[model samples]
Target: MSRRCELTGKGVMVGNNVSHANNKTKRRFLPNLNDVSLMSDTLGRTFQLRISASALRTVDHRGGLDAFLAKAKDAELSPRALKIKRDIAKAQAATAA
Candidate 1:
């Protein structure tokens, strides 16, 4: 898989590495991604996701995986994450009914 955050869709950023002599070199700034297993209360299951550290913190801040997914924007999420988001919504709706 590519170096990208599944939840936040954060990927490598291109930049320049400047030396002391004012020489510029190409550099890639990668997101701080971690493979984590997050448990969902509504779904009663755990999911493995490669997410960024900031996204992990955001998930915690929002309470849990369910809340984060509900509040996250579709454009910002990867295809896999978007599918998971849809599943989460379905599970929540089923539980609510």
Candidate 2:
């Protein structure tokens, strides 16, 4: 598996590291990811995925698990993670009021 977030689609970003002497070196900043088991209402199963911490936070902030998943679907998320995110997003929206 790659160092990518299954939920937010986070990946490695490339950049340059500069020094006071104007020296530059190639560098990369990786997203914060975690391995988690998400329950999917659509499939009625649990799937394990690697997701970014930020993506998880976005889901939590928007509403709950279900609502978060819905947002991911709208964003054209990965096929493997779609069901779980959708379920979570819906559940979140329902709980919000």
Candidate 3:
């Protein structure tokens, strides 16, 4: 899999590393990603995602996986997360009906 955050779309960044002799080398700055299993209280299920540490903190700040998905922009989410968001919405609708 690519080194990218599924939630925040964070990915590797390109930069140059400078040495003491003013020599520069191409370098890649990778995002801090972790494979995490986030549980949903409404669906009573857990979803595994590869996300950045920042995204995890945001999820926690937003209260949970559901809340984060509900408020996050669709363009910022990965395809898997988009599907999960839709499923959560459908489940919530079913429970309400």
Alpha-carbon local distance difference test for all models? 0.90, 0.70, 0.95
**Candidate 1 vs candidate 2, TM-score winner:** 1
Instruction: Score every model by TM-score.
Output: 0.93, 0.69, 0.92
> For model 2, what is the error of residue 16's alpha carbon versus the real structure, in angstroms, after optimal superposition?
0.6
Clashing residue pairs, backbone N/CA/C < 3 A, model 3: none
Candidate 3: where is the Cα deviation over 4 Å? none
Ranking by TM-score, best first?
Answer: 1, 3, 2
Model 3 gets an lDDT of 0.95
> What's the distance in Å from true for residue 37, model 2?
2.8
Candidate 1 runs further than 4 Å off:
none
Q: Residue 13 in model 2: shift from native, Å?
A: 0.4
Shift in Å, residue 8, candidate 3:
0.7
Q: Which stretches of candidate 2 lie over 4 Å from their true place?
A: 39-45, 73-76, 83-97
Q: Looking at candidate 3, what is the lDDT of residue 20?
A: 100
For each of the candidates, the C-alpha root-mean-square deviation to the true structure, in angstroms, is 1.0, 4.8, 1.1
lDDT per residue, candidate 1, 48-78, as tens digits? 9999999999999999998998988999888
Q: What lDDT score is found at residue 82 in candidate 3?
A: 94
Error of 1 at 25 (Å): 0.9
